[model samples]
Target: MFSDFIELIGAFVLVLAILQISSDRLFFSVKVYALQSFFVALSIFVIGLYSSSNDLYISAFLTLLIKVIIIPFTLFEAIKEMKIKREIETYINITNSLMIISSIIIISFILTRYIDLGGEIISKKIFPISLSIIFVGAFIMVSRKKPITQLIGFLTLENGIMLAATSVTYGMPLIVEIGIFFDVIVGATMATIIIHHINETVDDIDERTVENFEE
Candidate 1:
């Protein structure tokens, strides 16, 4: 039962990532990120329940508090304030994006097949998914033209790393987890401010325009 839940949560998070990259709507992507973060937190909580790890419990709580709730709320509010609705363009079309994402997943599975991390057997199962999430998140950062969409991609990448750490090692040191959370919160807040500034300075927050800037 425990292993089954682990696989299920990991798979669902991967599906959400696929969904996010396939969509052009910025708000929709942000909502998808929030859902993905929720699953990451849930996975930690489930693992903690089975392992009786207090650190995992606290880590799960922080994930819920920061990733699922606060960050999303802040981004959503920032978007509302900016009155931005959707991504102006994606460098890769949806059809090609799906193809690339599929290829990334297959390659991840192939790459991690024989490697062993010496943690839970389930960690081996999740390793490829975590790796794929990291790659796909990076792809998201590059393939989307909007800064906000890239920010969402960055956050997704972080969630993938967190998922791997929580599942593989069972949990990191409590203080380390807390420090990571602090860094993420600070980074997210700063990124949001930058995005807002971009929106204010330009008619559209498109990356293409950024390259054309005189400076």
Candidate 2:
């Protein structure tokens, strides 16, 4: 019953996450994004319990610490620094986004069916959701214009990738996990710098248009 609950929670979180990505409000989306990571952390911990893997449990703790806590705080700070409004302008309509997301979910399930996952019980069941989450994350990054939103999207995708890897492999080696986290830290730092440049490049559409015309 406990494992089943965890499994359901994981799937539910993924759904909320994708919806949050499609939202037109920036702060609300970020809040939902953090909520998604929290549920992911919980799911990881629950997976550790079911698998009886110490490494998974540790990884879950770190996932909670880094993803749920530290990363969100960092992102919030970035958002404040940018002083951007909470209003988001989406190029695509919400209904179309929902349809596309549904299609991605179907595609994920179909693709997951072809591969034989590790000999784990839960991994196979969760695999489709994991893949969907990744695709959704990537979709969020490219679909939005704001760089901050793009960073959030990328991190959300990272959460899915980590969930997929750890859930499938019972967690990677300690060294590998550390290296991956380090790389993520570096990536976030670099992304912030790029966002600063993007903000400076064109604060308004007319400036952007002039720059484009000049090119």
Candidate 3:
């Protein structure tokens, strides 16, 4: 019962993340993205407890560090420093963004229908949702204009990847998980600094505008 509930909650977070991606305003999207991360962390943490595995604890901590802490802080600093206080000027129109998001959800359900679990209870359940979440994260990154939004999408994708690993295997070796988590933390901090520099040097938040740098 608890596992089912956790899976449901994970699915909900997936929806919320995509909803944030669809939002026209950057601040609201970032806030929603943060909330989504919190939910994802909570769901996974509970699942880890139910399984009584130490690696899931590490994964839980990774979610806390990556999704709850690093991603949100970077996003906040990036937007503040960039002075991007306006609503997001989307790459595609709002209506089209909604359409694409809806399509992603639908396709995810279909794709999840055929996961080859080899008759394992654990495999049968979480893999599909994790894969769908990853796909949605990628879709958001590709659709959004703001560099911060793209980073949110990327972090969310990593969340999905971690979710898949945890759900399918129940846990991995703690040392390996911690090492990978450390890499992500260091990588995100570097990304934040690089993004800040890019914004200052080029005077824009849209990465596509890099092409317009004055000679």
Candidate 4:
């Protein structure tokens, strides 16, 4: 019963990831990412309860704290400081993005069907979702021009990796999970600082502007 619920939450997380790809509003994308993180944490907590793993519990707490609360708070503050209210610039239109996301989802399921997950039902259910989330995150980073949006994509990619770890192994060791959390926090902080500097120097966060630096 619990496993089914957690899988349902995982499915919703994938939907949220797809929504992020389809939406152009930067703030909306960040909020969707936060909600996805919250669901992922919930899924982790459920898995810990089912597996009786204290380490998974700790990982879930850390996920809730860092991904759900701290990172989103930092992004929101950065958005406020930058006074950014414009929609994200995307290389493709929304319809095309949606079509691509759909294709990715179909391909993920097809590709996973040939791979073995050792007869773990939950792993079988989540493997495709995690892979699709990762692909969508990469697509978001490639298709969007805003630095903040790309940062969100990177975070989304990390979230997919965490989901995969939990699905495959019921979670990694506490120390390893903590290390990953630390890296994410530091990376997010550094990225936020870089975005601020880019905004100040170029007066824009568009990737094209930053890449065309003369010197």
Report the C-alpha lDDT of model 4 over 26-88, residue by residue, as the tens digit.
778889999999988998998888888899888999999999899999999998888765568
- Where in model 1 is the C-alpha error above 4 Å? 85-88, 119-121, 203-215
Would you list the C-alpha lDDT of every candidate in the order shown? 0.86, 0.74, 0.71, 0.85
Ranking by lDDT: 1, 4, 2, 3
What is the C-alpha lDDT profile of model 3 across 101-178, one tens digit per residue? 778777877887876667545645577677777887887777766566677678778778777766677656778778
Better of 3 and 4 by lDDT: 4
Error of 4 at 95 (Å): 1.1
Better-scoring candidate (TM-score), 2 or 4: 4
In angstroms, the error of model 3 at 109 is 2.3
Off by over 4 Å in 3: 123-125, 204-215
User: What's the true lDDT of residue 203 in model 1?
Assistant: 74
Error of 3 at 207 (Å): 9.2
Segments in model 4 whose C-alpha atoms lie over 4 Å from true places: 119-121, 204-215
Q: Put down candidate 1 lDDT per residue, 1-215, tens digits, no spaces.
A: 78888988999999999998887776888899999999999999999999998999999999999998999999989878877544546778989999999999999999999886763465567888989999989999888766778889899999889989888778789999999999999999999898777776777534323443546
For model 2, the superposed segments whose C-alpha errors exceed 4 Å read 201-215
State the lDDT of candidate 2 residue by residue for 109-185, as single tens digits.
99889887656455465778888988988887777656677787888888788877766666788778878877887
Model 1: how far is 13 from its true place, Å? 0.6
